[model samples]
Structure formats: structure tokens, C-alpha cells
Target: MKKILFIDRDGTLIQEPDKEIPQVDSLEEMVFLPWVISSLNMFIKKWYKLIIVTNQDWLWTELNPRENYTNINNKMFEIFAWEGVTFSHIFECPHFESDNCKCRKPKVWILWDFLSENDIDYKNSYMVWDRDTDSEFAKNIWVWFYKVIYWDDKHNWWNILEFVAG
Candidate 1:
């Protein structure tokens, strides 16, 4: 069985813009957090498969068009590739909170297939993210959870390494 690190995208992997609703709508808004690359590299060195599980609200709507999202997302992947960091899979829920989608965060419906097919080491696996919903997601999936404070300069995003090392 393989150990995995289920990470969030905005606010966790990259800097989430200070908007009414945080979303990486454009390339300029997709700034990466400090020490993120190194921390993720450390997890990789520990033989953990990195997977991105995120909730992107109103993704296909006119407010957050699909084309704009694709451009920024592609750029983020490109940058990560340049840094030698690659994710095993990226599962996204593009639905509004009112939509009550089964794939949204805190719900394991979307991951049911992946979980059944793959041999995952649940004990060693973890969900690293910056939201309460993410914590709930970890609980739903029966994996350990690590809450990361994105705005805290003290942590500086390097605290994630503690999970891999200790």
C-alpha cells in the first residue's frame, strides 16, 4: 500500500487572494506560498504520493469561466513541473455550496472509486490543508489531517515538513 498526501489547492498549495470568495481566477492571482516547493519535495522524498483534492466554487459559471481557470491551472502545473514536483491526481469539485454536490469537500463520494482501486496506507496517509472543510474531508476518508495556517508567517509553510520527518 502507498502512502499519500491529499493537499488542497488555493490557500494550501498557492496563495489564495483576499477576495469575498477566494479563488485563483487569473494567473496573476496564482502566487505560490513560501517554502512550498521544498516542503512538497520533502514529502516526495519520503515516498508519499501527492494528490490535490480541492473545492472550486462556481467553476464553470460566467463568474468564474472555465477558460480562465484552465489558463491559470495549466500555468500552476507548468511551474510545479519545472520544480520537479508532480501530483498523482487532481480531483476538483466545481459546484456551489448550495448545489449540494456529492463530490464537494467533506464528502468522499468523488474519491470512492480511487480509494477502492488503489492500495492506500490510510494510517500513514494524511490530508494537508487550510480549512475546516478539509479536516472534515480527512475524517470522511479516514486519513490523518494536518491543518496549515496559510496567513501565519511563523509557520512559513515549512511546518509541513514535520509531518514527513517526524
Candidate 2:
């Protein structure tokens, strides 16, 4: 069975833009969080399959153009590749909160196919994210949850490394 690390993109892997609805609209707005690359490298070295699970609201809509999203996403992948950190899969929900889509975070509908196909070690697997919905998602999937407080100076995102080390 494979131990997977389900990660969130915005605010967790990258610094979320401070807006009413925080989203990385363009390449210029994309900024990776501190210690993200190194911590991900550690996870990869520990033999964890990295999976990105994120909610991208208004995607492909006029509000959030698909081309813009693709450009920004591709750049993020390129940077991660340069750092030797690669994601096994990326799952995104492009529905708004009002849509109440089954694929949204806290719902496992989008992951059902992957869950059925893979021999996952849920006991050792973890969900690392930055929101309450993400915590609920971990509970919904019956996996360990690690909440990342991006602005916490004391942690500075080092707790994840410590957790993985232990």
C-alpha cells in the first residue's frame, strides 16, 4: 500500500493572495510559501506519493479565465519540478461553494475513482492543508490531518518537517 500526502495548493503550497476570494489569478500573483520546497522534498524522500487536492472556484468561468489558471498552474509545476518535487496526481474542483458540488473539498466524490484504484495506506497517509474544509476533508476520507497556519511565525512551517521526522 502506498502512503500518500494529500496537499492543498493555495495558502499551503503557495501563498494565497489577500483578497475577498483568495486565488492565484496569474503567474505574477503566484508565490510559494516558505519551506514548502524543502518540506516537500523531505516527503518525497520518505517515499510518500504527493497528491494535490484543491478547490479552484469559478475556474473556466469569465470571473476566472481558464487560460490564466493554466499559465499559473504550469509555472507552479515547473518550479516544483526544478526542486525535484513532483506530484503523483492533481485533483481540482472548479465549482463554486454555492454550487455545492460533490467534488468540492470536504466531499470525496472526486477522489472516489482514485481511491478505488489505488492500494492506499490510509493509516499512514495524511492531508496537509490550510482550512477548516480541508480538515473536514481529512475526516471524510478517514486520514490524518495537518493544519498549516501560514502566518504563524513560531512554526514557520517547520512543524510539518518535525511531524514527518517523528
What are the lDDT figures for the candidates, one per model?
0.87, 0.88
Per-residue alpha-carbon lDDT of candidate 1 for residues 1-166, written as tens digits (9 for 90 to 100) = 9999999998888988999878777888889988888788878888989999988888999988989988998999888888888999999999988999899989999899999999999999989888788898999999998877766865555776775455
Q: Which 10-residue window of candidate 2 scores lowest in summed lDDT? A: 153-162
TM-scores for all candidates: the values are: 0.94, 0.95
Tens digits of per-residue lDDT for model 2 on 1-166? 9999999999899989999878788788898888889888888898899999999999989888989989998899999999999999999999999998899998999999999999999999989998888999999888898888777864445787678544
Best by lDDT: 2
What's model 1's lDDT at 108?
92
- Stretches of candidate 1 exceeding 4 Å from the true structure: 153-156
Candidate 2: misplaced stretches above 4 Å?
154-156
> lDDT value for candidate 1?
0.87
